[model samples]
Target: MTPTPDPPATLCEAFQRTVAARPQEPALLALAGTALTWAQYAERVASVAAALRHLGVRRGEPVALMLTNRPEFHVADCAALHLGAVPFSLYNSLPADQIHDLLANTAARLVVTERRFLPVLHAAAAGTSVRYLVTVDQVDQTPEEGVLTLEEAEARAPRPFELAAALDCVGPDDLVTLIHTSGTTGRPKAVEITHRAMLSQLSGSQQVLKVTDQDSHISFLPAAHIADRWGSHYTNLLCGTRLTCLDDITRLSEALALVRPTLFGAVPSVWQRMRTTLEGALAEADPGLRALAEEALATGRRHAPRRWKGVLTQAERKELDGADAVLAELRRRVGLDRARVCITGAAPAPEGLQEFFHALGLPLTDAWGMSELSGIALIAPPGMPRPGTVGRPVPGAEIRIADDGELLVRAPFLMRGYRGESELTARTIDAAGWLHTGDLAAVDAQGDIRIIDRKKDLIINTGGQNMAPARIEGVLRESTPLIAHAVVIGDGRPYNVALLVPDREAVTAWARRTGIATAAPWDTHGAELAAAFAGAVADANARLSRAERIRVHEVIADEWAPGGPELTVTLKVRRAAVTGRYADLVETLYRRGAADR
Candidate 1:
């Protein structure tokens, strides 16, 4: 491997150079259907930076960002970098108390947020030291009593920096981005990501995904997460690509069609939910239409090339081309035809899902990394995907497994360490500069990594038994019309208990076939489909141990809500949240004593 290239002196100047080179090009597309040219983007960033400096935001001080995915977020972030103040993201949905704690913990004086979220800042800032709050939205909604509008704040100040010298003090080792972990178990710790670390991630992603100036991204994912921060934001900035950030999930589909992006980042749940929606909708329609849809999908899957398998022959190629028309129509409906690549990260997506999309002609590439590594650790090459595996380590990164099943990573892209927690920082990152990723994983013969699960999530029963819920969930997902996600609840009790969130449409269709009359819908649907889910649960139980078996459980109609203990912004379950939310339900599952069996 060649020595890594040097990083730019400052992240802000790099953007300015790019804008100067491509002023008229589209730099950002917002969920509101608004587009910003590189020139416009640069102007906004400059104004915001100047405004921040005038407000006495000093270099090296932290500026907390609490806005959702919007155009202001980009401008505010770029502007903060220009002012040489490290920008940290706080989950916009975090409870006001938690938000206040984070603000005090990070010692941030300046905060940027949307008008709607100002109440949270008000409540959280009651006794905290956060002195100024700037609302990022364009609406003239009544600003909180003391907080100012981001626009007004900027208008009051002069341009902060006229040239590179003003930003020359920001070196590669200086903090560029500070991301906080999803504080499920404890208070969230700020991860210091330096310019060098971010550049390392950007370079690796560019090489692996072959991102170019022509590339376009739909950036609705929370900028708080490293996956979205690097893959959807910084990568686009570094490669001179265009980014489209949407307001919410409702606007995402429209944004996709409008932007017709070449590259986008997604989590597995999004892909799975979309697939389930399409399949269930088609299945419920008339027999002829359902058959036609299934045939089209199957045909597409048949023609799609397998990543792990060898290349197809000439005859195979011809057959796939013949089915191109049907597949193209299907792709358009799914809004993925324009996408050259869809990168999935944060969690392991089922391999079969990746193949299904590939068959439809969308290359769904899987990547692996953590918040500590700034996101890009490994990724699959286009058309060379290995399903279930998180591809190989990104360029300039190294991965190794310990004797005890822990995955370790060493890269310049690694964070500077957990902020203010020297003990945890020392424990997570070793003297050798390797991050001890607490995930259990294996590197295959082909150098692909298949992560099993977090070592911490491992279940240790009272009977001295250990089990991985992820493995059990994987097996349960194999069932036709599969489960969305399952959380095993039994720990100290005699056996495991799983609280399953069923694929509602699938279960509803199964009900229609089984002749179950449905009167009140949605809320009562879970109870109505209890018997069906039980049968599936029983089948899964047969494969588990006495301690690991899910003896009894309940079904939830919809997924857990984000910010509602059960789900993270990326839609991953906080196990503690899930267990705590349904503690009574879990206990009811095993209410009957072990002797009863």
Candidate 2:
């Protein structure tokens, strides 16, 4: 008979083991000018655990966190896990109605939030299951009923609370967190993640990245997202790496220069902004400098290793060395000079953007995963990423194409199920334990997964030809710096049309250079601007198939953003919402026999 393997350890147990071994190591650096060693952080976790216990938080109970990407978020998350409580993360920007809905759904006992969000929480938690409102920041107003500050909680809790026995009670099967989906289609569903799944994901990340204690990271993404929680927070805890928490995401470009992290992860939108900034800077540079930078990038690309299998020849190395100054300056500008590995995920990035980063000596590799996976399942190997492909599956993850062309994954890190949605969960995960990913994917000969598009987002034209709108949108955005966002519309239609959102800054700069008087981006809608957009559409059309080519396009003046009806918190465009809002504009493109622009 085969021997049975030891059961997986709980997240709390794993964290304790690391803390015991590296008590003196720097664990977290807060942007507020405070740093916590492993020992100090563990102490805080214990204290927070005691406070929660005093507050009557029990095993399997949900403790909601509505804070930003701060050290307190990590502390509260770990503290809840220490006592086997489930940590439910809530976006700070969520409206009162959604907050109330989620709170009612989870039946959260306590909500840890800051003062700025107190008004919303106060309204949402009224007559709900919430027993207490734990504020992280102090406020001038008197404490309301059931509201207590973090300091007050700690003061009431007994000192030197023992956590070993409580942690030992936690098992791998215990629910670790309840992460909600982005709800792009409809209401957000809570995904039940387990300790075993999170641990498996951390193990896979460790195997692929080989991160060490010397490596550093900065947390700027929303902590509510699984990619940030599992990929950055939990990974750092398990690896004994230093993590810096950013106070404001708007200052990320400046933070990068200060933190100079060795490992960084961001969505495609952030990468696009960086690329646009760099391009704009280069375009404004002197002719000599521009030429030098271009030559350096070309040389870097020529000498860059493929699949981490090639070595640069001595002559090529020498040529690259000559451009080191320019390369270093460019890298410093983007705050990636020290980045050994930079990853982009959540949404697919343009192939051109990845190639541009590669040419600049920064391998911005593509990663693929969803909230249901607990963490990323597919990440390009360091120094060996293949452009346009979200690399092969990580260890312990099995990926196969379904009969209907959807990607099916059987992974140890898959979520337990959707909380309070048994019917939906059963429909998602089959009897064979395969999680049906709603993405259409194609595996190359090398086993790399190239995602085509979301199965439901596929646009079938009147000619019976299927086209991926995401692919076309990616191409459209990459073709011109002026285009910030693009949505291709042609489902069951005669031809494809596009709704484009222009980059306001880029357009304003162009107008200034061309001596066009414009008060704002919308004011500069002259023949010149029209020609620029038309040129961009033509360029994108040249690369697409005849049937997939965008025949007509219109530019929208208003910018799409989070907190808007047409966008999710992560800034993903809601197709139905956008189409409905601009229904007349879309109809005009197809109805009036508009010229191909």
Identify the leading candidate in terms of lDDT.
Answer: 2
Query: Which sections of candidate 2 miss by over 4 Å?
Result: 1-8, 32-34, 305-308, 508-518, 594-597
- Counted clashes in each candidate structure: 1, 0
lDDT of 1 by residue, 297-326 (tens): 676677665422557678876766666776
Model 2: worst 10 consecutive residues (lDDT sum): 301-310
Query: Residues 283-351, candidate 2, lDDT per residue (tens digit)?
Result: 889999999998988877776654144577677778878977898899999999999988998887899
Instruction: Report the C-alpha displacement of residue 544, candidate 2, in angstroms.
Output: 1.0
Backbone clashes in model 1, listed as residue pairs? 50-160
Consecutive 10-residue window with the lowest summed lDDT within model 1: 519-528
Give me the overall lDDT of model 1: 0.76
